[model samples]
Target: MTASANLWTHTNTEAVDARPLDADASADLVIIGGGFTGCAAALEAARSGASVVLLEAQSVAHGGSGRNVGLVNAGLWLPPEEVVAIMGEAAGPLLIEALGRGPETVFALIRDHGIACEAVQNGTLHLAHAPSGFRDLEERYRQGNRFGAPLQLLDRAETARRTGSERFHGALLDPRAGTVQPRAYCTGLARAAAGLGAAIHEQSPVTRVARSNGAWQVEANGHRVRARRLLVATNAYHAGAEGAYRPQYVAVSYCQFATAPLTAAQRAMVLPGGEGCWDTALVMSSIRTDAAGRLIVGGMGNSEGAAGAIHAGWARRKLKALYPALADLPFEHHWRGRIAMTRDHIPKVVEFAPEAYAVFGYSGRGICPGTVLGTAAARALLGAGAEALPLPVLPAYAERFTTLLGGYYEFGAALSHAAAPRLPV
Candidate 1:
């Protein structure tokens, strides 16, 4: 299949015209995968005066990076209490603190680099899918506030006013969160990294890695690039390479459908405040407007094969129900991606080898967590200081149930979409 039809078709926005890899090269660090984590590592390493080579099988941001929802929110899939509960008080607190600054770091980088990804800092709204969801948001707000999170709890009316929709009960807004055009952001980082003298190679899939005579030998695109350190930044979309490490996580699918730009009047009413919003349902939904006023609605779904059409239809109905003004608006873009989810829901950093690491499993919270963890990991990889990866690497096992679990999620998404009632707003 051509690259455009892949789950990450949003790459059309970032016009990086890099060619395929064809030559052998060497560097101080060899990073596999060119998504958020990989590119962030490349940028950080190059900025640190390390000779870094970043390789991607396809294009940069061709994976989940380009398929992102562009949400720059703090924390992970699990709530603060749950995170602390799973990782214990001290470790969880450190992680929360680190991620809390996720949006700050992201916006700073965007502004510094002038990446044109429609960077909007209007904040993000976490809407409640039900009363229980509101309670959950309340607890999260309390926990986040106690931990210095600048969060605001909004009632249903406030939520309606901000979102321009009355489907939600309530919401929690974090000023630290924002939105961006993801592909542009990734390409911008790559440009900044390359301008800083980092070597970035597209379509250079590293197929083998071996420690021969005390150096790491990485073979990709018929050439061997040797380095002292290696980084496996390929997350859920990883198709295993010969020598790279894979993080232990299940590949959960997240899909989105984008509508045509709203009419002038519709734009004035829908997401008029320019905030990115997501709900609290078990099968949740998200809403946001692009730089051109195109509304994007996303949720968990089977984003591949035969089930894609069903998900697409469900997205159509959901959009109409959410906004009566755009009831007849034809969706212009539909795409999906895999999110890495650990059984425990917290992200994982594995010490696969000496000076070699694999970072994955951000669940659905990519923007802030990915930015923070990727930046910190790059620092850690280069032996910068103690401020690298606040949480310790725990022993993890890749369960055999991952494929089955993925099938179940797909099954549920298909069944749920099929059962969706075509009710009018």
Candidate 2:
């Protein structure tokens, strides 16, 4: 499998391999997918001294991992109170409390492994797109504060000052959140796992995986590998496989465009808080600066190729509206990738057999949640129970023909965006 390029085509990292599969191999575990989740699980399992084999249909970070918003945010898509209400007081609070520690886990790994990705730990701002959104932020703030989160709600002027954009009513700032160079980060995990003795194979498209004689026989590229446990980490890029767990999902895509690094004079006026920021618009958009000061602005992406031109045009206008000072600046890179979303905006894990499970769906929030959950899942498998895992394992949210939903979400986002004026600074 060859590596695919996306908005993360930065000069800082180059993909390491595109090799073939292992022939007649057996291991304690076989993980499918090469994105953040797969890499994290591989790293965790290998570090634990297990015999591990990670098979990627494509190169590492070849999916959403390479095309993410790069925000290492804390918590989940659901609010603290809402999570408590849904997962019930006991299980829900337990889940949120663990996820609340996500940023620290991510940052500590970055430091301990000495990964060279551009890791920024200052903070992140969640801006309210409307006054009503401010009320939502208020509730979230109270709930998060009660849970020991270091979050602050800022007024309109403070939000403008923090984001360097005056288009929001207010915002919730999470001090624990930060940003990173996503591809570099994913590759770092893979390298670390390999260093710890994991047998990671690229271009290994698993064509068949079946439970045979109480063990998993996984075939790929004319080779067969057997394992006691199997992990499926193919989320948004899952190629349909027979016997694979069907995931219920609506495809949501996000696109991004990056300007060349800002001049010293230009850098002074953008993201002065040195924090990543995204607004709570119906069709959300994120804005942030790279370590080199290149500003990336992203929003919903379209599956239709024709919509590319429209989104590209909209991005130009949105950039102008967000920062009138850089309205005339040239954009250097542009790309888009899909996000797997369930109706409830929660990820699901399904056990396909006695010892095999497939973990999928993260709606677009990939980095922290992906690693935190994926690593925990690997440990749970190794430990033979879900009790030690950080999240509540959701086993039965299944749907078919998920990839088709990509077009539907794109159409909806395109129509909604068509009716709105460009972002107003």
Candidate 1's residue-wise lDDT over 248-350, tens digit each? 6778888888777888888888888889988887676789998788898897886565788788878888887778668788777777888887788888877
Please give, for residues 142-224, the per-residue lDDT of candidate 2 as tens digits: 98999889899999999887777787899999999999989888888888888888888998888887888988888888898
Alpha-carbon local distance difference test for all models: 0.80, 0.80
Please provide TM-scores, in order, for all candidate models, with all chains considered together: 0.94, 0.94
Candidate 1: residue 421 lDDT (0-100): 65
Full-model lDDT, candidate 2: 0.80
Candidate 2 Cα misplacement greater than 4 A, ranges = 1-5, 12-18, 400-405, 422-425
Q: After superposition, how far is residue 271 of candidate 1 from its true place, in Å?
A: 0.7
Q: How well does candidate 2 match the true structure in TM-score terms?
A: 0.94
For model 1, the superposed segments whose C-alpha errors exceed 4 Å read 1-18, 385-387, 395-397, 422-425
Model 1: worst 10 consecutive residues (lDDT sum): 1-10
Report the error of model 2 at residue 40, Å.
0.6
